[model samples]
Target: MSGARHREEDLLRGISASAGMAIGPLRRYELPLPRVAETAADPAAERQALAAALETVAATLESARHSADAQGQQEEAEIFDAHLAWLEDPALREAAEHHIAAGSSAGQGWYAALQAEIERLRQSESALLAARVDDLRDLQRRVMAPLAADAGAAEAADDDLDGAILIAREMTPSQFVAVAGRIQGLCLAAGGATSHLAILARARGVPCVMGLGEALLSLTAERAVLDATHGVLESAPDAERLAALVAERERRQAQARSAAEQACAAVITRDGRQVQVAANVGSAAEAQAAARAGADGVGLLRSEFLFLGRAAAPTREVQRREYAAALAALDGKPVIVRLLDIGADKQLDYLSLPAAPNPALGERGIRLWQTFPELFETQLDALLLAGNEAPVADAATPLQLMLPMVSDVGELRWVRQRLAARAAELGITRLPALGVMIEVPSAALCAVSLAREADFFSIGTNDLTQYVLAMDREVAGLAAHCDVLHPGVLRLIQATLEGARGRCPVGVCGAAAGDPLAAALLVAMGVDELSLEPAGIAALKAWLRELDAAALAARVPELLALDDGAAVRAVLAAWLDASAPRGFGVMSERRGHTHNKQ
Candidate 1:
């Protein structure tokens, strides 16, 4: 195996969980999960032990829930709430007590009760019920902490790991939060690219590489260069190597700044293909900035932001004003607003969502509207109100509305009926361009059906990739296989395109759209629009200019035929290297050679 521990002047490689480069001191932090012990014990002692463990787990959950609620992490708080309910379940408490009374250790009792409950839930017809097994597993870790042999060590440590390249065997979601700002880079022996740890790492703008293997765990270097852009960790690097890395980092930052400077221009590929580059903004201020940056338009408004950070739901007029302000900021450009995609990762305090062990598959997205009619109706009313009041010139901007988590034609028909009713009620003849988000595997498969009724299609690759591979993006263990480049995900995108044919405009607004590599591939996939974060607009624009659409499009069949993400990446990398046109020394120097032939 090529994976080896570097004692001195050597390099280790792993998956790039985040894109960036960091030079920092190496700090090792290990938070070992406590092991459950099963042993015979007196009924009295077992009861006492069980009670203590329950108290600790409950207190921890309640604290986290309250803290999350205060910090606008309402969605995260729901996760803790579910754990608290499980702890207070009468049946679960009774089962555990029975085991304790039977002379089982507290750990044994707790494990038995959790397993029995999970098994019962798994037998249910509902898929959400079956998914609760993960929640139960997460609870076991927290509950077992106080009961484990190393309970004292489970407590918080005093060391500060900020500004350090954190190395660990595995990191939980909580660990990422604790050392968030302080950690300049992250290296883990476990978890995958799309794990919760990886997600947080990226959000914090920290360079992170995971699934690095066992040798990295014992790394004791005081300082190292963590190049997460390419997933390379260098220890005791030669001076020459350090200088080269530093220079490369600077060049990338320069390129990023230049891309932003040229943000207002249209991005056309070398093969003469024009791609619409847009932004995903949450507020009017961001919308204004996107316009200044020269974005084609807003891709996703994340309308849930309107309902969050408040004690009650905002009035319909309140939503309309906010939506109107954002539309005005766009300066007549088209904006695609996805209505209230809450429940999984995003939640609203006013909405009473059922506690699900796995909320991602729960009553979220378009499902939330069906369960709560008023929610969807009010939002639709606001969109129509804002649309009708828009100026004649900007009215051509088209207030595009998109539905999320739609599974079947019935759901589309139901929402369309509501939209038409709202438009009629408002005495509006021209309704906005209505669209469905092709996120769920079902919608992708039934795209032709949805296209026949809808005005346009916006593919949400984030949820689509996760569901297509059956990998939860939040699960650290499943990160490796959660890539959008997976053949299955690409096939589904192709499926949606084929089914829709030339019937509707298709756009991609997920994280994939923001990625330069994925953005290139997406255009090659014949995607009409590419919506990315504001910051990536320039590089993506520059990156687009490097691509030959016909060259990329012609190889679509071969690329789709490849079953492995790694194979797909290799093909694209080779193509980019070969086809990259000669540019200023800035971009070409980084690639080591110019595209002289091109």
Candidate 2:
């Protein structure tokens, strides 16, 4: 239809939620909120009705949680957990009760209670907190649906949006779950990278961009190009522009396919040094994607996904199945499973640990594990059992267990004791290789001592940068300051490498590993492994084949002496420009300073 018209091309920029490119017809999707009517009611009866509606909604959310988990959507299941927590909040119930006592009906009281909280969240200083308003609204709708006089009031038929990029002011998880597989792409006028919708979009591999603002509403294009990688949407493109986009898309696809086909091979630099390029996966599905993308193995397997969203800690067999399935998906590739890393930031209702004023700087990761031995012992048992049942990987690619947020060698030693004890109890002869994640400044500073105990070391640059700069990654609009390329952060990385001192494999499994400039720098710094997102694997591999790692190693001192992240970026950009043949289009095109560019 777009080809039939001669329309002017217009480009709109927004925050990218997921990375990919899609061209399709535009379909505006609008989900109507369930309405509640004001009515006179007996206060006591209204209170009872409110209680019953809350329980019903809570039960529905619990059911959805189980269903999502069954379908391998652990993240979506976690969203329901948050909703359930809100549903049972005593303050919310008391607010509705007060309204009911003041003569409002149950539906009206509940609506008012939720709206007050939503408004408060919207006014919060933290953008991450404010972005949760849609989640609250979703709760409002679920509860109101059961409370509405007409039982079928909120029921709506699914739209035929297949092969179309759906645009909305904002979307709730409930609406997204219903049509996630049907939509080709997604565009939102309002949402940040931390929103539940954005998480779901990324998990589903949907090409999505959000926070497009009022400009999105004015888009009248019948067909458009959604380049989520760059957060650009080309609307109402003319024939020439459309053809160019189509060609570009095809070329990118072909390049990706070719790179992936060659990715499984060992990555040996021109100087005859071999480096492992791996993936950081959270689920079995992700592991399969990594294998397809030609990842050497999985460097960081986030085991926390299994623990979250559930009422109790996952049983040994349950965690074992999930872990084993992930290993099986990768055939014989190695997997370094990080034990439960939850704390105040990522709390489990079942685990009652001491309260901390600052969750980030307080009891978390290995500390949390130490505080609750029973919680982590089961996971250790699961890992041991999984390795036994899963496919036997290469001797060089043995299964590994990693400890998170370990600031000292004492914590690593403690975990090793527990893991060894668990393996013995499980009658396993050989223990899996144990490692530590160098996410904290203390850990990076003491990497040498940790490497003496740890079988390997994985640098989590995202957290390391945040910790080094005292900048929280969740704080919106601070992305520029929280850059991993900062000289201080790079110096810490250099220290980590020096600590390893060829004693063990030191890998970076953070944002830096996926970034072309950072990845190149890490390779030059003598990092033995680089584990990144699955999508970035192939392109990085293609680019690495053209790199002279030994030659780049000579330039490391120059980078380490750089004043700031911008200067470091400028230098890397120049190097990329000088090496024209090695310019992998996807990696060379920098996405610096992208707001909410998750």
Candidate 3:
């Protein structure tokens, strides 16, 4: 047995929670509660304790709710508000009291009741409700942890660390709220990025790594370094390693600042070609940040947030206020708003949707809008009001309307007609430039026809790639096929661009636009604009400036002749590498060499 095998080193890995490095003392937060046996004797005392516990939970939730409101995290606050309602529920309270009276310890009784209620909720037909049930179960575990020992007290007492690593088997949203900005990094034994702790980490910009197995058990309160970039957790690092990590961190931060500065600068090619570099924002705060980052305009303003949680469709006034806030934050910059794209994947209670055997192929985007004509009308009215109210000096601010999931020219015409009707009702002579997302293969195939009816095109690569490959991106097994760099996907994009040439503006707003190599290919394909995350804008702009579009155009035929996406990527990479310091159009030497092989 000894000769056959040996135990491997115990190494743990997990999804990187945030995008930075941090070395800090471990601060384990364990919730506090009394022993089960201690509270069994006195029913009245147990009742009082339960009431106090419920009040404490209410207070904690309220504090979180207020914090979220102050920070303009309304959606986040809703999660806490739901928890508050659960705590105040008469059924839940009665169940907990009954358990205590039946001789269970106060803490155990409360936890048991909550867990049972959560389980019952899990049987709910609503997926959102099921997700909420899971959240409640997590909260119950946190609320009862303090009962185990004095360890909970130590965790609660750790409110003053300079930099601390939160070690937990799993953390509740409320627990994370309590620690808030006090911690630098978080390491969890279990939990995925969708967990409340991970969500909070992302919102707060704190470094975190979860699903570290039992690594949290081995960690000490002493300083430990977490390299989120490489998914490495270094325990008790020596001075040299610590210094190196610190220096590297500083360098990365400097790079990030430099990137931000560069992102705002004008995106002019070396040969004097100008292209607008904008942000795809989902919220008003994001819009403001993107504008500050030098976004020429908002290429895509998602309207899902306004529709997500409401019991009924948002009124025109409410939508107008929201749209106005987003436009105002942009300070008159163009905000290209995409009407609600919600459907099967993002089901909303307000909308009556039939269950589809294949939702991806079913009604979504413009289809959903077509089905619910009133919703579309309300949205159009709000957009028109916002546009009219916007300052006249920014009249040419390019507030284009884009319809999502438009698979054919007929869909485009239908939407345009509706848009015209809405405009007539609003006493407007003409509507803003209307566009269609070239997401479906059918749209790409018939781009010219669609472009004839629409004023512009924005490629929604996320859905485009999914549809082209017939693969679900969220499914782990199909992730490799989800690559936007695939030759088939590129061909679709090229076709779309070719179809839209000279007819209307063509922009790539999907994740592919952010990739340097992919952006080069898009430019080579004659794409007019590339909208991406703020961080990638400067780098992309730099590459675009260096690129000789004429030279790239000369090489396009050779690239198209290639059958494989990987091969095409290789050829592009080689061309970029040979072109040194070429401006925003320069490609990596490695990528150029790879492409040359093709």
Which candidate gets the maximum lDDT versus the true structure? 2
Evaluation by TM-score, superior candidate among 1 and 2: 2
List, residue by residue over 160-230, the lDDT tens digit for candidate 2: 58888888898888888888888888998988777888878877888888877777976766678887865
Error of 1 at 129 (Å): 17
Q: Write the per-residue lDDT of candidate 3 for residues 142-239, one digit (tens) a residue.
A: 45544434425444455545578777776667667667677888777765443455546655767777667776766674767765533446666666
Off by over 4 Å in 1: 1-18, 27-219, 229-241, 354-358, 394-397, 583-598
In the order shown, the candidates' Cα RMSDs to the true structure are 8.2, 4.8, 7.0
Clashing pairs in 2: none
The C-alpha local distance difference test score for the whole of candidate 2 amounts to 0.79
> Compared with the true structure, what per-residue lDDT tens digits does model 1 show for residues 1-598?
0122344447777776776778777888876446667765587887788888889888988899899767755335645665676676667778887988887778888888888877885674443344455467666667777887777774666365757888987765655666777777889885555344554565466788876789898787766788776567886765666677677678777877777777788888888889998888766656776787678988887787677556567789998998898889886788788888878756564577877887778888888776888877998999889877765564454578988899988888888898899889989877788888998999999989989988888999888987898876645445456778878899999999888887988899887786556677888888888886555566677777778888888888988789787788678767776777754222332121000000
The global C-alpha lDDT for each of the candidates, from Candidate 1 onward, is 0.73, 0.79, 0.68
**Which predicted model would earn the best TM-score?**
2
TM-score of 3: 0.75
